[model samples]
Target: MSTLANETYEARVVAASEPGVTFSGALSSEWIKFRTLRSSWAVLLAAVVALVAIAGLIGYVTGSKWDGQLDPEDRVASAPLQGLFLAQLLIGVLGVLFVSGEYTTGMIRSTLAAVPRRLPVLWAKGVVYGLVTLSTLIPTTFLAYGVAQLFLSHFGHSTSLSAPTAFRAVLATGIYLALVGLLGSALGWIVRSTPGGISLLVGLLLIVPVLLEVVPGQWAKDISHYLPSAAGASFYSSLQADGALSPGAGLLVLVIWVAVATTVAAFLLKRRDG
Candidate 1:
C-alpha cells in the first residue's frame, strides 16, 4: 500500500476502535457499580419490604378500628402511603451510601480517573440512583396500595385507584421518593462521608420539621411548608393541610431542591481533589 493510504487507514482504524467517553458510558458504569454493591441491594429490599408491610399493617389496624374509633377525616387521610415515612429513611440512607461508600473505600480515585471530566460522574450517579428509586418505588407503591385496600375494603373504607385524587397520590409517592434519593446522593457528594451525609439527611428531612413546629408563629408555619420532607409529603397527601403546598407545587419544590443540591455537588466535585 502507498504510505499515504496506509496512514489514512491506520487513523480510521484507531478512530473506530475508540468511540470515546459519553454520558451514557458514565451512566452505565454507575449502574454497574450500584448493582454490584450488596449493601445497595439490601437497603433497597428493606425499603420495599417496609413500605409494603407497614402499609398492609396500617390498613389492617385501621380496618379493625373502623367501627367507632376512626373518624371520616382520619379515614380519608390514612393512606397506605404512610409507610413512606419509613421508606424515605431507608432510601435516603442508600443514597448517602451510594457516593459516600466510594469515598470510604478509596475507590473514588479510580472512578475519577475513569471520568476525568468529573461532573459526568456526579450526574451519572444521580440519574442512575434516581431512576432505580423511581422504578422500584412506583411498583412497590402500587402493590402496597392494592394490598392495603384489600383489608380496608372489609370496613367499607377502601378507596379505589379511580377515586378522586387516588391515582395522583400513588404516582406522586414514587416521584417523591425518587427526589428524596437524589437529594441524599447530592448531599453525599457534598459531604463525602457516610456518617455526615446520613446525619445531614436525617436532620434535613426529619428533625428540622419537628423543630420548626416549636417556633410558634405564622412565620414558622410559612417556612415549614418549604422544608424538603414537608414539601415532598405534600405530593402524596390526599388532603391538603393548612400549611402544606399543593401537589404540583410540592413536586416543583422538591425538584428545585434536588437540582440545587446536585449543582452544588458538581461544582465542589470539579473544584476539589478526589
Candidate 2:
C-alpha cells in the first residue's frame, strides 16, 4: 500500500482503540476546532460592533430630542432599552449562523468525522459558544451602557450600572444573549440550513409574533408575553410590569425554550442521517 494509505489506516486503528478517551478530552478537541475557525471570531466581533453602533446611535438621537422635560431618570430609563430590540436580532443571527454556517460550508461533516459521537460535539459547541457569547455580551452591553450614559450625562440623564435596575439589565443582557445563542445553535443543528435556521429564528423573534400582536386582541398580548423574545424582554424592564412576570420568570421562559430546542436537536442528531 502507499504511505498515505498506511497513515490513514494507522489513524483509523488509533481512533478505533479509543479506550482511554473521556468526555473532557472530546470537549477539548471540539473547543480547538471551534476557536481555530476564523469565522467564529469574525462573526462575534461583528455582532459586538453592530450592537454598540446601533445602541450609541439611538442614544445620540434620543439625547438630541431630550427637551429637558422628561427628567434625567425618565430619559435614562426609556432610551437604554431601545437598542436591545435590534441588538437581540444581531445576536440571534450570529448564534444561528454559528451552527448553520458549518452545514452551509460543509464543515459539519468534517466536524462529525473528528468526533464520531455527535452529541458530545453538539454539547461542546454549546459550552464554547455559550461562554464566548456571554463574555462578549457582558462587556459589549456595559460598554454600550457607558456610551449611552455619556450621551445622557450631557443632558443630565446619566445612569449607572450600580443602580438596581441598571445592574439587572447588564446581567440580564448577557444571560439573554447566551440563551438566544444556545437556542439558535440547537435550531441550526436540527435544521442544518443557514437560511432555514435563520428564518426560523427571525420568525420566532420578530415575524410570527409581530403578526399575532397586530391582530388587536387581549389574548394576543397575553400570549405574546410568553414568546421567547417577549419573555426575554421582560428582564430588561427597569420597573417590573403589573401582571408581567418577575425577572426570574422571564429567565425561566428563556430556559424552557433553550431546553426544548436542545432536546429536540439532540433527538434529531442521534436518529437522522447526517
Candidate 3:
C-alpha cells in the first residue's frame, strides 16, 4: 500500500486502541480544524467588519440627517446593532459550513473515526465555535457600539455604556448574535447538507418572521415576537417596541431555541448512520 494509506491505517489503529475520546482531546482537534480553516477566519473577520463599519456608516447617516431629532437612548440602543442583520447571516452561514463542509468533503468519516462515541465531536464543534464566536463578537459589539456612538456623539444624542439600558443593548447584541450562529451550527448537524442547512437557517431567521405577517391574528403577532430575530431585538433594541419580549424573556427565548435545536441535532446525530 502507498504511504498515505499506511499512515491512515496507523492512525485508525491508534484511535481504535485508545480507551476513549476525551472531550478535551476532541475540543483541541476541533479547535485545530476550525482555526486552521481560512474560510472560518475570513467569515469571522467579515462579520466583525460588517458589524463595526456598517454601524459607523449608519451612525454617520443618522447623525448627519437627523441632526438632533434622534433620541439618545434610541440612537445608541438600535443604531449600533443594525449591523447584526448582515453579521448574523455571515456568522450563521459560517456555523453551517463549519459542520456541513466536513460532510461535503467526506472528512466527517475521519472525524468520527477519531471519536467513535460521536456526541463529543458535535459538542466540541459547538463549544469551540460558540466560544470563538462569543469572544470575538463581544469585543466587536463594543467596537460597533463605540463607532456608532462616535457619530451620534457629535450630534449630542449618544448615550454612554453606563447608561441604564446601554449595557444591556451592547451585551445582548453579542449574546443574541452568538446564539444565532449556534442555532445555525445545530441546524448544520441536523441537515448535514450545505445548501439545505443554509436554507433552513435563513428560513428560520429571516423568512419565518415575514411569513408570520400574513397569519392574521393575535397569536401570529404573539408568536412573531418570540421568533429568533424579534426575540433578539427585544434585549438589544433600545427602543423596546410594543409586543416585543422583555430583555430577560428574550434571552430565555433564544437560549431555549438553541437548546432545542442542539438537542434535536444531537439525537439525530446519534441515531443516523451519517
Per-residue C-alpha lDDT of model 1 across residues 32-105, encoded as one tens digit per residue: 99999899999999999998898789888888888877655556543777888888989999999999999999
Reference-based lDDT, each prediction: 0.88, 0.77, 0.88
Between candidates 1 and 2, name the one with more favorable lDDT.
1
Tens-digit lDDT string for candidate 2 (41-155): 8767777776677667767766777784554544645346455666666667767777888788888888777667789878877888888888888888788778877876786
Best by TM-score: 1
Q: What are the clash counts of all predictions, listed in order?
A: 0, 0, 0
Model 3: lDDT to the true structure: 0.88
Give me the displacement of residue 198 in model 3, in angstroms: 0.6
Q: Where in model 2 is the C-alpha error above 4 Å?
A: 1-20, 68-78
- What is the C-alpha lDDT profile of model 3 across 161-223, one tens digit per residue? 888778888888898888999999999999999999999999999999999988888899989
